[model samples]
Target chain A: DAGITQSPRHKVTETGTPVTLRCHQTENHRYMYWYRQDPGHGLRLIHYSYGVKDTDKGEVSDGYSVSRSKTEDFLLTLESATSSQTSVYFCAISESTGSYEQYFGPGTRLTVT
Target chain B: AQSVTQLDSQVPVFEEAPVELRCNYSSSVSVYLFWYVQYPNQGLQLLLKYLSGSTLVKGINGFEAEFNKSQTSFHLRKPSVHISDTAEYFCAVSEKAGGSYIPTFGRGTSLIVHP
Candidate 1:
């Protein structure tokens, strides 16, 4: 297991409210990623950071924003939560993107009512 | 760009039965392949990966996958399965693009082992 942790393992929020999910890693991996898992959709990347203060949008970065201030922490913020945004979010870290595999955190389940 | 395809959405089998999960991928250039398993309410765990070398790659928990470059497929297989093997399996392919390595994932295939 990797030294990865996701805060607020579970959360429930109403629609139109702002919510932020935090991912922290102790492995000091160079690459960090955020993904959402749905029933039919296995896993879709939300955003990822290659280095501190640097981030890029994933395929499903429509209403999500992420920030990485340091090497260990990556934050995903939903400006105004929506019911459709309710899903399980997972944070993963990889030493390098080339041929290395990713390590995943337990995951955070968010519900938007 | 790289993409993955899991041929089956769900496969049900009896415990101790042999099982195989199909995975196919498409990429313009040479790519890396990986297989991951996700249990209920848990995150994905790497089962195995094929970067280079021999086509047969062994992984954890009595699992293995054979990477076929000609077919562009990395299919996961297990000789005998237990009840604990019930989980969702995902196939992924990674390739370098725009100076960054990006991975594309397949919609998982649920493996249900019944007693």
Candidate 2:
């Protein structure tokens, strides 16, 4: 319960459409991450932000882009949704003062058809 | 770059039975290891992590893991598991620093505990 929440708990979009998933936090953590969970694949990082306006790519960041404009919000966008991008997306936050234990949001299930 | 391997794709056990899930990792530099659990229809939760110091790390739900640097292993273990312990367990590793702390996760092991 780190006060993390993901919007649009579920979504369905056609291929080649733009989709954005939102993550909001209230604990004011310094680090926020975006990850997608696939069957048998565990969780793979898509993007992460260490601070406001500072972000980096992850292993599966090929078609995903992320931006963090405020300390509490991190947004993940799919330029053009594809069938392969359909998965459960999770947002996690870590604090600079704690043991780096990541707290996750419930998740957002996106289906690209 | 770092990678993690979960040897068991699935494990089935009865209540009160001891269980162990094997994990192995590869990294050139010092790395941090972690175990995460994902219940049905939920996000992954950190079970435990090995940052520094102790090789043996205990996490919630009576779960523990031992980091063997020489063997490149951090296997998750429990003396006895309960029905509620059934979930998908993931082994992950991250660089100590420099690489944004983005973790690489294994394929995951599905643990099924029966009564």
The candidate that achieves the highest lDDT relative to the unseen native structure: 1
For candidate 2, write residues B12-108 as lDDT tens digits: 9999999999999888677888899999988888899999999999999999999999999999999999999999999888777665356778999
Model 1 residue A49 distance off true place after TM-score fit, in angstroms = 0.2
Supply the TM-score of chain A against the true chain A for every candidate structure: 0.99, 0.97
Provide DockQ values for all models, in the order shown: 0.78, 0.52
Best by DockQ: 1
Clashes of 2: 0
Evaluate model 1 with DockQ and give the value. Answer: 0.78
Q: Model 1 residue B72 lDDT? A: 88
Q: Which pairs clash inside model 2?
A: none
Instruction: Give one digit per residue, the lDDT tens place, for model 1 in B30-101.
Output: 788899999988899999999989999999999999999889889999999999999999998887554237
How good is the docking of model 2, by CAPRI class?
A: medium
Winning candidate number (TM-score): 1
